[model samples]
Target chain A: MKKTVNQKAWFMVLPVLLLVAFSAVIPLMTVVNYSVQDTFGNNEFFWVGLEWFEEIIQSERMHDALIRQILFSSIILIIEIPLGIFIALHMPKKNSLWTSLCLVLIALPLLIPWNVVGTIWQIFSRIDIGLLGYSLDAIGVDYNYTQNAVDAWITIIIMDVWHWTSLVVLLCYAGLQSIPDAYYQAAKIDQASRWNTFRYIELPKMKGVLLIAILLRFMDSFMIYTEPFVVTGGGPGNATTFLSIDLVKMAIGQFDLGPAAAFSLIYFLVILLISWVFYTAMIHTDEENQS
Target chain B: MRISRSNWIMILYILFLMLPIYWLVNMSLKSNQEILDGFSLWPQAITFDNYMTIFTDSSWYMGYVNSIIYVVINTIISLTVALPAAYAFSRYRFMGDKHLFFWLLSNRMAPPAVFALPFFQLYSSVGLFDTHIAVALAHTLFNVPLAVWILEGFMRGVPKEIDETAYIDGYGFFRFFGKIFVPLIASGIGVTAFFCFMFSWVELLLSRTLTAVDAKSIAATMTRTVSASGVDWGVLAAAGVLTIIPGALVIYFVRNHIAKGFALGRV
Candidate 1:
């Protein structure tokens, strides 16, 4: 059906436009301001062009963080994507009661705040007070996030999986459910094998949602701060300090606004670039689906 | 014709997915003394002390209020603005319309860290720091875009004929939208609101950065507990468990839509 248009609809949208400009555009300009200038109280400012950016680019601190951030996000995507699809496939789609139960189980961790996830694990893994920690200790293994960097990293990563795999499961499940019965009937009549049925029919349909799940997981995992901060305090000697933790320390802990702001823009650009890539691919896939 | 090797792989995956969350509910039910004692397959003395603390304490209840207030505000602000903007984007192809939508999403792309200092500075400079409004506005930076995008999708799904049908019947655009468009996309609004609420509720970065003292959020307060004179494990666990209730309830109610055609609704 054809719909009529109204160009005057611009008036209806003016408020949101103005609000976004005020909320997003203006503060971003302030970040731009801090990135290039040195200020020594009383509103005094001195120009320092590209110095902060250059230092950030060369520093081992940033280099290490970039590697860790990339590794963490990559590891999560690799594990969660296929695993999420697997879980979605197993999920009961026909029964509403069972569907709700599965959803509740999957969403269990997403509701907990990052700090609480940290707290839960912090207590749950201690030999004295945490069940898993005590259990592992009883089995004659030394496990402590406070002392071992690898242990800390693993705990943080696992905690994130517990929290977010549900999202992927939910999205993948949605995609799987969209398959009409006709498709299955056709496959049955053709005597197609299960693998062939999924590869040709289900996988194609689920790709759109899988793409969104991957993108969302990437963005969220990249920006994750509160959990690691709470669990390790970016600690066991800076082993778990991602860019967000470093950015926070620089801005709040060290009062290094110029460098922090510059770092922030760099951080924003990295995420922006990655998301733009993912967003482009998702949209392209979406267009392909439509065609 | 048969359950393949892939089916076994799926069973293992679901079991892996369920374990940690199972561990949490298990941990929550254990008594503090039992938690400290040792690992057992089940809690030796299951107790309600943790859940009980949340119900009794004003602090825990206050967390609920603060989370609720800010979340509700953010949802309202997001929907109010995004609804009309989405209408514009779906109905009219204006100059920079594509850029505008991308710009909204680009706001989401920027890390909270990049904007943390500026948000704090901007809010403090205007004497709005540590207030609920600061958090609401900060959240809107991301939520508004999401709202617009999701709403636009839903609006697109509703063919434009409905708008014309109402318009030709002497209902102007405002009345048409008021009487027609909004009602049609009610579920879209609900889903968007659920997301807005979820994101705003679970968000710790900007919320912590923005508020202190009277407006200090639950997540911020929980972090402060580490430095408090003594650790109260039961109370902390209770608060943690309590915080999960709202989101759990939300997911439970919205689980049906979890598999619904949000492709046409998610922004």
Candidate 2:
């Protein structure tokens, strides 16, 4: 039987479509306009065909930044996905106060602005004035985010982990909680070991969430800016510059709009493609669960 | 239902989680001298100077005010748009409905960096550049998707029978929604608002790109120092610690609703 469809619901969607179109779609179209054109500094754009895209794709600078972005995002996904799940598995589900406390603590890093996270760690990791820096120095270990490329990479990765791991943990924990106690009871009666229960029951239940966490983390880490920017200024001499950093330097610092716009589109497509892959993976997992 | 060795693991986990926060609070209390002097678990002498900077410095506190204003505005606007959109997606199937839903989700996937240059140009053309609205509107790109995604979860959870019965009782669509659906999803709306607030609050790239002066965020303000002389590590730490308060206040109230909200939608 067909149900009576309310046509009025269309009104509800109008505001969102208009608002989003005005803000997102229009500006994006403008980017597309800039992407295919050459600007001559008088607010006049002449159609330049594929010259900018060709320049960007052939440039070593773009290639290097793309490699760095992929590497950073990949490392972030690997560490964050597993660490987040482990954390979610360990977090308390019972005690109300303890749950609240854990929630508050995990959320602390997320609340701080990205630049501040970089700043906090920058100060916290300084050899002379920073705590981590001085502590490492005192312990006979050398540490300098600004001087050593490896240290800079480690600091940036750790800073990101500290900042975003909670989001994954929160997502996974939420997924964990939604699985009814009946599943755990079944596992208990089957005499499944803790690892087996996690492998067979909890992991399946959490696959969807884990996919989303990975995708979100991958996209954000690939596009990360303020934290690394503040921490190393994309330096110790270009050791940690991600795609977004390079784009900003081109667009804002150097005022290279043509190259920057081209780079930005590539950056967007990479994120879109990666996210689509994850989304398809999630759908595949959901189908497997049904089967 | 029995306590086991897993409990021990939980205890260690809690401690690991609490330690960094403890360090942050510890540093906030210390003088710049103590922070620079050495790494200590406790501040040698506690002081309110860091907190004082937030109050006495107009430029610093303005970031707080601007962030709050823009975040609040964006959250409200996003929800207002999303509530209707989510309801439409949940309640009805119309022409292009599936296409619309995917479109909204795709917006959530697009990176903000790609749009930053275009947004700067678009807003400049419209005379909206470098203002609170510019950032708030830019933020709505993602926030609207988030709100709709979560709100769609809440709407789906509501039984269709509820709406049917309300209509039988002579309730019109808007009246039924106002009286029945809105209150039923009150917790959802609150949760969505909290998450939206969280994202908009912590976001730096779009916010930074959209504003430079008169409405610069603390995140952007902190970046400004990098181009200048020796970095102000102490003041920066103070500023960093202060940014956590609003989010803490939000999570304190809405933490319960958010877990379920996230799991149902993006997760």
Candidate 3:
């Protein structure tokens, strides 16, 4: 699709620009201001000039949280992406009542409030009352999210997989549905195995959507807060405290605005840098495929 | 005839998806005593008292009202701003367009945790604190970018000849858009609105930060159920159940369009 070069299109984009500036830009500038300044009570402030950034960069807590955050995101991408693709492959491809039913059920978790999702798992996995915990105990397995660090990590990961895997499934399912029946017919004529059909036909066609799914999952998992906050409160001695959880505790809980602001900038920068790399890499591959 | 292995897999996966939700519904129907007593496959003494309490309590029900109001407002605002921008991006290449587009997407990637405190002060200083519109406007930070991205994907599929044809037929830009172009991408709009509504509705950090009492979201309000005495497990479960209703309804209404929407749109 060749697009005309039209500077007048800027007029069309103006409204979104103004709205985003109001909502995102001004607050961002405030974070920048706070990052560089030292402030006491009663709104009194002094110029601190990168002191907060220096301290944050040197902080052990920040380092631990960053490592934990990266680990959590990696685990999430690993589990959810393949699982989602598998489920999408098995989903009813034909338009029927069953397809709609499957879609609605698959999407249910995604629509629930983030905290509610946490609450659901919190209840469903409690040792005293949760179904999973009670059953696990009955089976002679030791498991308690509130008391065990490994258990806490497991619960958070499972909860995330339950909450978000549907997104991947839906995106992949859409990609799958767009493949014409003729492709499968050609595969059948060639006596291709299931793996061969999936590899050559499905995988190539699904690349665009797969990239989008991966990017979304990465960003969202990196910034996850509410569910983990509600479920564990980043507790068991900060075992599950991802960066956002740690930042909120610092900024809101302890009122360490300057350090928290600096932390926020670094956190945002990490996401920006990684996503830029991802975007360019995916787009480059897409162009290569086209040629 | 026996079910195929693929059918069995599908059934098992759906069951896995529904198990937690089923537990929530089961808990919602049981008494607090029944829940704490032990885990049961079904509610032993099924009760609607929890639902009754939520309906009769202003604090409980108003949370739902507030959430719905802000989500609706945010969707409308996002779509209104995004539609033209999406059209512009889809149809024309302007200066810094790629950079501008990426910049918009970066906002979607921004962590709400980072924005929570600044938004608190930003809303507070503007006297928009504790208002529904405050959360609505704050949500636009992410939702607008997403709405634009999704809508742009759908709009790009429309042939360029349609616009030229409309102009040649003497249809004005606004007239052409409202009359022909919008209807063409109606499902796309539905999907974009659904995504905007879903994100805004589910988001807790910004919504909780921007509003305190007058406009607290249901998600934020659910936090209050955990008191020193103990959590109101039944009522809490009921509130969670109620929160899912609107979303379920929306999904049902948009069921057919969803696949097509995603197939065409960028989301």
DockQ, per-model, please?
Answer: 0.52, 0.56, 0.77
Q: Cα RMSDs of all predictions? A: 2.8, 2.7, 1.3
Per-model TM against the reference: 0.93, 0.93, 0.98
Model 1 - which docking category? medium
Model 2: residues >4 Å from true position, as ranges? Answer: A1-9, A283-291, B1-21, B37-39, B223-229, B265-267
Model 3 alpha-carbon miss at residue B46, Å: 1.1
Docking class of 2: medium
lDDT of 1 by residue, A1-291 (tens): 233465676787799889888788899999888889998888899999989999888889999999999999999998888878877887775766645766666766776777777777776676676666777888898888889999888888887877788788778887888799999999999999989998999999988888778878898899888888877889889899999999999998998988888889889889989988888888788778766
What residue runs in model 1 are displaced by over 4 Å at the alpha carbon? A1-9, B1-34, B37-57, B228-230, B261-267
**Candidate 2 residue-wise lDDT, B1-267, digit = tens:** 675665566666556545555566677788767776666767778788877876798888888899998999899899889998998888887778766876787788776777777888888899988899889999999899889988987787788889889999999988998899999999889989987898899888888888988888877775543445654445666677778778888888877776776665533
Cα error, candidate 1, residue B9 (Å): 8.0
For the predicted complex of model 3, DockQ is: 0.77
Q: B48-120, model 1: which lDDT tens digit per residue?
A: 8777766677766676788788888999999999998988888887666667677788987777877788889
What TM-score does the predicted chain A of each candidate obtain versus native chain A?
A: 0.95, 0.93, 0.97
Query: What are the lDDT scores of the predictions, listed in order?
Result: 0.80, 0.80, 0.91
Query: Which number leads on DockQ?
Result: 3
lDDT of 3 by residue, B1-267 (tens): 888787798899888878888888999999999998877889988999999999999998999999999999999999999999999999999999999999999999999999999999999999999999999999999999999988988998789999999999999999999999999999899999999989998999999888788998898888888899999999999999999999999888888777656543742
